[model samples]
Target: MSVVSMLTPGISMNSFEATAHVVTQLEVQRVSYMLVGALSSNAYGIPRATKDADIVVSFDSIGVVEFAKSLGVGFKLDRQMRMETITNSIRNIITYTPTNFDIELFRLSQDEHHKERFQRRQRRWLEEIKREAWIPSAEDVVIQKLRWKRRKDLDDAENILAVRAKKLDWDYLNHWTMIHNTNDLLKQLRDECPNLDVLDEE
Candidate 1:
């Protein structure tokens, strides 16, 4: 469902507003984070509405609970942290009281690609948030989505390949996909998208 449709009616805060508020809170807490999930995919691929915002955070200075508490009114942080099965990362959910929208904060994991992707994240102007925010590179988004291989994720990866064909760093993409055992899937996506030129410039 679209973010607007998912929001509670008569609420002043829309999905972008709720996401912006959560991002502002993270900035206030001085947490290092990168926007991910549907939002990240939307930046590179076809635009699609999302009900919630997902972020990967490095909580170097403060504990998770304390950070959530600091969000103060209009936000409630779940005390119970859960393991995300696909990535096996710990995540906490924060509910925006006004709109009942969820903001998922995934603790940065020690996985090799996770660390590399965070390091490679780029700052882009987010018109919705009215500020520059960190987001994964298009190649990383493609790699991660292919690794996940869910129906939606595969669709997202294919869309990204379709839209960002010429600009992609094929060598870097090939290396990681091979390491993650997603090279075949990547190849399949590329093959399926007839408009994507098979030749790599780099």
Candidate 2:
């Protein structure tokens, strides 16, 4: 797992502003997307220090290359589009490196149910001074994270489970886990962290 270091001292611009600029670009481009990952969760009042922004877009033909270029993201496209391509069905993850932060673009799976979940995303204006836009709902975050099924993502889910254990919708999580065939992972989580409550059964 890649353990990206946290921010250091004296960085002029905070990640929130940088992320907002990217969001503004996406908005200007009319891309149908929703913020996710650390930034989104943090924006939702989780308060995690995030160094990058992840925006999950529709898996259809969105012309993301043009969108990225329009934002002046300074990315070099591969002629074959191996690193970033349009033909692939799975969500494409493209990274944009600006000065202080790197933004990730996720082309979410083209599932109507999943897409609807994306539509259900709610933006919360977190903090008066920060004015950070984040998706505050825990159900959505946990659902998406479970779908991702990456090792780090699982760890993040566990951490979130640790924090929001008492409040999580265990029935929903369990149902989704069964649908996604990740009940083993839940079992593993429960095994490793016997004390940390996750599902409603606990």
Candidate 3:
């Protein structure tokens, strides 16, 4: 199934509208990051809402310090600190404001698999006056949410599961989960949300 098959109408317009503006600005400014997390998934029609937009970029080239300083030029940053850069790593959330959306920017890590995912990511959607793209695919999005291990992240994942259930490429989802060592979490989710299995698989 295609990405568009997953989302129903009106489930995520507000968030996308807000995201489009920021991404447009970034592209215009020649910033080199791709949006990830919920917004990314939602763009691919996963149907989930996120409080803020999460982005991953080649911060090694740009450097987190320089990126932070650049962001300060037009944003009111909330918190800025370093965080792991990979699946099991931590990186800082350089959150900012005034775009009516929270922007969480992070540098890509040196992990080979993480780097591969970054390189293979699909463009979020066709051009919309904003040269925007989302990093993690649907399956990866599920895996990351599970890794977070937060109640809210879990809930969000469940929502994605429900909405995208019909269109989910289970084989692909399983592949990424296993690669990321998140099979246990997928099992946990399957056990916790009994209805998940009943979802119409596209």
Q: Which candidate is the best by TM-score?
A: 1
User: Which residues of candidate 1, in runs, are more than 4 Å off?
Assistant: 1-12, 197-202
Q: Give the candidate number with the greatest lDDT.
A: 1
lDDT by residue (tens digit), candidate 2, 1-202: 1112132222334455545655655555556667777765553323556656666765344576666555443333332322223213334333433454556665655564366567677766545214434353566676666677777666666666666677777887777678767767766764665355433232
Q: What is the C-alpha lDDT of each candidate?
A: 0.82, 0.55, 0.58
* lDDT (tens digit, per residue) of candidate 1 on 1-202: 1112233323567657767666666776778999999889988877777788899999988888887776556778888989987677899998887778889999889888888999999987666655667899999999999888899999999888888889999999999999989999999998887555543222
Question: How high is the lDDT of residue 108 in model 1?
Answer: 89
TM-score of each: 0.87, 0.64, 0.64
* Model 3: per-residue Cα lDDT at residue 146: 72
Better of 1 and 2 by TM-score: 1
> What shift in Å separates residue 173 of candidate 1 from its native position after superposition?
0.9
lDDT of 3 at 128: 30
Can you tell me which runs of candidate 3 are displaced by over 4 Å? 1-21, 29-32, 44-49, 60-74, 77-80, 85-101, 125-132, 191-202
In terms of lDDT, which candidate is stronger, 1 or 2? 1
Candidate 2 at 157: error in angstroms?
Answer: 0.9
TM-score leaderboard ranking: 1, 3, 2
